[model samples]
Every structure is written in structure tokens, then in C-alpha cells.
Target: MELYGLVTLVGVFLLLALEPVLARNPLHHPRLDRWCNNIGLAFTNELIRFFLPLALALVAVDGPWQAFNASSLGLLWGALLAFIIMDFSLYWVHRCSHELRWLWRLHRTHHSDLDMDVTTSFRHHPGEVGLKLVLMSGFIGLLGFTPAHLLTYVLLHRCFALWSHSNIRLPEGLERQLAKVLVTPRVHQIHHSAWQPETDSNYGQILTLWDRLFKTYLSPDQVPCPARFGLEDFRSAEDQRLSALFAQPIR
Candidate 1:
């Protein structure tokens, strides 16, 4: 798990470096301070998870879950089923984080970033990470997903999170077609809009199907173009500081 996590981290950074050179979005202006704060948050989150009991629990139960596999489903079919269940579970978890005020306090940290980029993907609060682990553990245990299935899903989830938050722009036609199935950059950008209505919609992380099925999906055309990013209430530079973000939930 540690090695896989390291590889995913490296891949994310590589994509971060390559995106601007390949297809940059003019709206995003990267800043050193913002990157530092974002990375700091990610480091803090990793530290928190490392010490959490949930991490140890996952390791201990991994082998047992595979050994007593009650599901006679074939490997390929089981993996696909697990992936869909995990994605669906995450959709509700994410949406609840917005609808519930307590969850919103922790989740708001991610939306406070004025500039969206690959680093923005790691800007979540440590509290939010812990909460997600708690929620995900329930789904993983209930669905009886194997360790291999969990690792693959985690890698794919991390990659897509980076891709969705990236500043690279795709051709309009292609982006439109992709949004029909997956959560494209344009679709995710709308979720970061400063406007409350736009921000509340498009809550899916990897698949667009959840939002569409739940009637929470909104296209870029539905809202103003070049939608303003970040929380309107916390737009100051000071609000993005590492210390400030760490204390934001209680504030």
C-alpha cells in the first residue's frame, strides 16, 4: 500500500508538471505560496491517516476478507461491481459533505482555493480525509472488496481527482463528449464555482452518472462561462494560508 501510494504521488506530480506545457488554461495562475499551503495540507492529511486506527484495521482485515470470500462472482465482474459500489458510495458521501453544515466546514477548505490546478486536488482538510476513511471503510467491508480491488480503485480515484482539478483545457467538442460519461474538467470546474448554486451541483468525482441520476448534474453552459472559482466568503489571500486553512473548520 505504501509503495502504491508513493507511485500515485509521483504520477500526480508528473501530470502536474506536464499539463501546463500540453494544454494550459489561461484562467489559472499558479502561485508558489498556494502550492506550499496545498502540499502542506496533503502532508498533514497523510500524517493523520498514518496514525489512525482505520489504516491498521484495513491491513488486518485485508487477508481475511479475501479468504472468506462469500461472493462467488468472478474476479473481473467482482472488481467492476466493487468499483461501481465505491463510486456510488463516494457520491453520497461527497454530496452529504455539502448539504450538512458540519461536514461543509471541513470540506470548505478544498473549495477555498481561488486558483484550481493539480495541487488543488490535495487541498482537502485532514478532518475531511478521516471522515472519508470512516465512510469508505463501511462500503469496503459491506461490499467485501479484496485488497487488490481496493488498491486499484484508490489509484484510479487519485488519478481522476488530479485530472478533474487540473488546469489543462480540452477541445470543446471532445470535452462535451467525455462529460457525457465521465466527470471532465469543465464539469468539475463548475463544482468549484464561487456561485453557490453552481458549487452545489456536479458533485461526482470520477463518474458523471451519479450526479446525472440524482439530478444534481449541471453543464458549463447552464452557468456563466469562466465561472469564478473558490468560496466567495473566503477569497482573501490570508484565508488560503496554511495556518488559516487548518483552523478554518472551527472558525
Candidate 2:
């Protein structure tokens, strides 16, 4: 858990510094309120995370269904399976966040960002965070997942989340190959497209397998990279305020 938090923060800071040099579409040299607001939101979430019990802190369940047994495999294999299962869970959770209107309200705070950058990855609503926590915890418990499995998965997930949301462009050929298995930045940029149909697709977090299987994927070649992001109506200056973000879901 400590490692998870450390990796997330470090990845964000590293990306923050590196983004300008590597940015596909260079944003303002010194970002204004938006960047700070996103960071502020992330800090609040870190506090929320601190108070909430860690993912592995759950009491073991004795249900008939067991998703994976960590003891059955070596640690490396267990972590690999754990991430695959967790990514699958994320694919559904993320898809639901867009497909369901009420849930979309909680999710829009993230998409509401007019810009797509590393910080945008941390712009989730508190309610959305809590919702993910509950749903993901249930999945973990059902599987009887181990601490080691979860710890490894969280670090990996967060690192990829930051990478996927980054504005830095990867080589098209390399990204094309990666998108075959993993969700690349190009793939995720399509997911953030302001167009509703495009926004609703590419819900995979780590792996492209689920999106491809479920047919929710919009090919990067089709939509094009560096697509316009965020909801059209939600782009007003007032709408970007930190206070407005908290009230957004209910409003």
C-alpha cells in the first residue's frame, strides 16, 4: 500500500516534468488553475485513501466461488493473474461509468477536464472513488486475493493510468503493436473523445482484451489520435473551478 501510494505520486511528478519535452501537443508552459485543481483533487483523494482500509485489509471470505488462489501459484504467476483479473474488473467498472447515466454523473468530473494530461487521470470524484472501492473490493474478496497480489496490481495499475492519460505521444508503430494487448495512450485518447460514441468505447484500463472482446473498442486509426477531449457543454471557465467540480454530480 505504501509502495502503491509512492509509485502513484512519483509517476505523476515524473510525468509532470517530462510531459512538456515529450508532449504531442504542447500545452501552456506553466499550467494555470486546472493543473493545480487536479492535483488538489488528487491530494484529497490520497487523504480519503489513507482513511479507507487498504485493499488487502479485507477479511477473508468463505464463499463457494474462488476466483484465484495465490497459494496455488508462484508469487510472479499470482501477481500476473491478479492484475489480469483486476484489469478485467476495471474494464467493466469503467464502461459502466460511461454507459450508466447516474454513474456517468460521478464519472464526468474526470472527463470534464478540458485538457487531457497526466493530471486528468487523478480527477475522479470522491463518490466515484468510493464506488470503485466498493466494487473492486467485492471482486477482490470474491477471489480471496492476497496482499501481495493486490499491492503489485495497484502499483502497476496506477503507473499505467498515468501513462495512458499522458499527453506525450508514443511512436505510432510501437503504440500500434502495444495496443494489440495493452491499452496505449492513443487508444485511451480515443476513449476521451468528446463525441459520445467515441467516449463510450475503449474502456479498458490495462489490457485491450476486454474492450476487443466486448466490441466497445474504437480503433485509434478510425478516430485519430489527439482527438478533442471533454464534454462540449462542460468547457466554461466557471465549470472548471474546483468548487464547481464537487457540486457537479448533484447539479
Candidate 3:
């Protein structure tokens, strides 16, 4: 857990600092107030996810509710299975958040940001945070995952997520190669597209496998460069205020 915290801290620090310098285009959100509110909200949501674990099965999995135990498959194989499950589960949850109306309301808080950058990665609503945490924690019990397995997954998934959401411009060839397996920033930028169809595509989390397998993959080349981000309804600058964003789901 300590390592997980350290990795997360480092990931956030490096990307938040680098994105502005390496940004492909000029910085969009110049308002300092919006930055403070967005970052503050993100911090609160991250705390909930890091601190709450009653729902996560970090101990023995002898309970009768166990559906399938991967421990029988050996440590390496079980760990592999756990990693795949974690990635794909995140894919479905993200996909469903778009398809399902209520989920979209919560998820839209993330997309509602008119300006997309590394900090946008941290702009998820508390509702979405709690929802994903509750859902993702189920894998530990069902798959017989230990604390170490989950902590490792947490570090990888979260760091990759921050990276994918970042605005740093990667070289075209390198970005293309990485996007073949992992969800690179270019690929994820399409998912953040303001266009409805594009927004519904590229639903992968850590890996692009799920999106390709499920036929939701959309190539970055298919969309305009720096695809327009944010939702149509929340386009105004004032809508991005901390209070408006916090109350958005109900509105």
C-alpha cells in the first residue's frame, strides 16, 4: 500500500508538471480558480478510493460466496488472470457509464470539463469514484487475489490511467506502437471527444484489448487532431465551477 501511494504520488507529480511543458498545443484552461477547484475535488475522490477497503477482499477467500478461485492455477497464472480481469472490468464499467443514463450523469462530470489535460484525469466526480471502487473491489474475493496482487494492480492501473489522460505529446510512431496494446493518450483523447459517437468509443482502461475485442475501438486517425473535448450541454465556462460540477449529476 505504501508503494502504491508512492507510485500514485510520483505519477501525478511528473505528469501534472510535464503536460504543460510537453503539451502539443497551447494550454487551454488559464483560470487558476478552476484549476484549484478541479484538483481539490480530485484529491477528495482519490482519498475515498485509497482509504476505503472494506469492500475489497485482501484476506482469505474461503467464503461460500466465492464463484471461482484462480489460486488453483498457480501464482503466476492467477496473478495474470487477476490483471486481465481488473483491466477488462474497468473497460466494461467505463463503457457502461456511457451507455447507462444514470451512470453517465456521474461520469459526465469528468467529460464536462471543457479543457482537457492531465488534471482532467483527476477530475472525476465523487459519485463515479465510489461507484468504481465498490465495483472493482469485488474481483479480490471472487478471484482469490491477495493484498499484494491488488496493490500492484492499483499502482499499474492508476499510473497508466494518469498517463493516458495526460496532454504530453508523444512521437507519432511511438504513440502508434504503444496504442496497439495499451491505451495511449492519443487513443484516449478520442474517447474524450465532445462528439457523441466518439465519446462512446475507446472504452479501454489500461489495455486496448478489451475495446478491440468488444468492437468499441476507434482509431485516433479517424478523428480530427486534438478532438474537441467536453459535453455539449456543459460547454459554458461557469458550468465548470466547483459547485456546479458537484451539483451536476442531479441537475
lDDT of each: 0.79, 0.80, 0.80
Lowest lDDT 10-mer window, candidate 3? 53-62
For each of the candidates, give the backbone clash count: 0, 0, 0
Instruction: Give the clashing residue pairs of candidate 1, or none.
Output: none
User: Would you list the rank order by TM-score, best first?
Assistant: 3, 2, 1
Instruction: For candidate 2, write residues 1-251 as lDDT tens digits.
Output: 57777888799889888888888765533367888878878887777665553532355444456665554676788788888888888888888888899999999999988778998898988888887787677677677676676777777778889999998888889988899998888888888878888888999988899988999988887776545778887888888889999888998
- How does model 3 score by TM-score? 0.92
Clash total of candidate 3: 0
Instruction: Score every model by TM-score.
Output: 0.88, 0.90, 0.92
Model 1 bad stretches (over 4 Å): 22-24, 27-30, 48-71
Which sections of candidate 3 miss by over 4 Å? none
Task: For model 2, state the Cα shift of residue 206 in Å.
Answer: 0.7
Candidate 2: worst-modelled 10 consecutive residues by lDDT: 53-62
lDDT of 1: 0.79
lDDT of 1 at 45: 82
Please give the lDDT score at residue 15 for candidate 2: 88
lDDT by residue (tens digit), candidate 3, 58-150: 543656767876667776777777788888888888989999999999999999877667777788889889877766666567667765556
